[model samples]
Structure formats: C-alpha cells, structure tokens
Target: MRAKRTPVLDRACRACGFSDSRGLTHAKLQSGETVTLCGTHELMLRRAGGAVDAGELRGVLSDRRDTVRRSVGGGDELAESLQEAFAPNRRRTERRAS
Candidate 1:
C-alpha cells in the first residue's frame, strides 16, 4: 500500500509574476502543511510571518511585538541591516543625480 500524495498550495510571487512552474518553492506552515510559492512570494511571506491562517499569523505578530519593540528601542541590528540593504539604491540614485 502507498500513502496518498499531499497537494501543494499554489501562490503567486509578490515581486514578479513567476508562476509555480518557474520559481515556486515550498514553505512549511505551523500547521505542518506546505505552501508553494515563488522566491519573491516567499520573501513576502517571511516578512509577514508564515502562518497557517490569518489568525495564526496575527498571533505570531502579536507575540513578536515585544521583541520588535525592544529591537527598535536602541542598538538594533535590524536598523543596520535595513541601512545596508538600502545603501546600494541610495548610491545609485546619488550617482544618477550627479
């Protein structure tokens, strides 16, 4: 006897419209189910907190609120990461203006 195959949930990429066949990858939810998404979409999901449902996602956000607050309070590594991520774009724009 063979076990049945589970279906993969298909989600479009948030950044580009690349469909599952092109760039989709899987993300395991808290519920243990997997969702298939493109690379761009996966990044978006991570930013939003991967959750099985909206309520679960909300709870994850609520649970992280304190951590976020503390990180933003001072000496945050997040600020540095954000700055590094945007610095290249800032330099490009400055070059364009000059």
Candidate 2:
C-alpha cells in the first residue's frame, strides 16, 4: 500500500500561519525558504526591523497567479534544476537593471 501523504498547501502565511490557495503571496526568505504571505503579512515584512531592513524578496512564482489566474506546474525536476543553474546570471542582470 502507498504511504499516506498530506497534500501540499499552495499557500501558507509564514507570519500568521494562515493558509489558503488564494490571496497568498509567494516570497523567499533570507534563509532561502519559500513561504506564502497574505497581503497583511506581506506589509509587515516590508517594514524595517530593530536596526536593519528585512532581507526577503518576492518570488517570480507569484503575482502572475492572481493577475492572470493560471496554474503552475511544480513537478518538473529538470526545469527546476536548469533554473537554479542560471539563477546567478539572472540575479546579476536584475541587480544591474536596478
């Protein structure tokens, strides 16, 4: 028999632990974990901390979902590997543009 598994939550708020597939913003933490934040929580993360600013960045996997309402495939291992390989170049270009 197949082992029981819990379906992954498409969105989970890292701040308040709220979770839903809708109204969630996907972002990457400074520690590199991908987390979903609601509008309320996203605002909180943008604020300055005690002495430094938050190091989080909104991920590319977000916004398009709500803006266009399209489904995304996360099971493509080869594609994910390729993306990771070029991540450095992508970051450099982004930095230059900014």
Candidate 3:
C-alpha cells in the first residue's frame, strides 16, 4: 500500500518574507515552477505585464479590515469615559515630619 501524501504547505513571499498567503500573488514560470510575491511586489509584477488576480488585492484589504474590527470592540467608549470622569477622587495629604 502507498503512504498517504501530505498537503503542500505555503512558503513565505519571495519578495518580503510574509508567510500569510491571504494577499500574496503567485505565478507559474515557463519551466512550470511556481513562486509567490507580497502585495507591493505583486503590483510591480502586474504593472510589468504579469497577470495577477483582482480578487487577491481585495482579499488582502478585507482581511486587514476584519482584523482591525476584531481588535476594536463595539462597547461604548463615551459611556465608559463619562463613568470614569464622575467617579470619586481621593486626595491624600501627607503630614510633614517636624
């Protein structure tokens, strides 16, 4: 019996070493070897006559937006700030040693 084959893991972007594959570009060479590129390098490649995906560009943006949204919560900042502002303040008067 033949051993099962493992899935191919993605490599870092050849241009910038970015490992996430979400916004990278890819190409298959004339020799049938494939390479990946980061967003900036991918744009350069496209402007230089290489064909890349529009979906890829949008994918990167959407992924970044979702990450930011997750980091920023839906809680009311104004309410929190107001509560903090109205809380009691304690002032300590230190007695000087005579």
lDDT of 1 by residue, 31-88 (tens): 8766555776566668876788544644543434245453445556888788877887
TM-score per model over all chains = 0.39, 0.34, 0.35
Leading candidate by lDDT: 1
How well is each residue in 1-98 modelled by candidate 3, as lDDT tens digits?
99998545357666557887787777543344456777776676555554344344334323333354554665599877876666555112443578
Candidates in descending lDDT order: 1, 3, 2
> How many backbone clashes can be found in candidate 2?
0
TM-score of 1: 0.39
lDDT on C-alpha atoms for all candidate structures: 0.62, 0.56, 0.57
> What's the C-alpha lDDT at position 29 in model 1?
71
lDDT of 2 by residue, 11-37 (tens): 567555677757688654556555567
User: What RMSD, rounded to one decimal, does every model reach?
Assistant: 8.2, 19.7, 12.7
Task: Tally clashing residue pairs in candidate 3.
Answer: 0
Model 1 CA deviation exceeding 4 Å by range: 11-17, 54-98
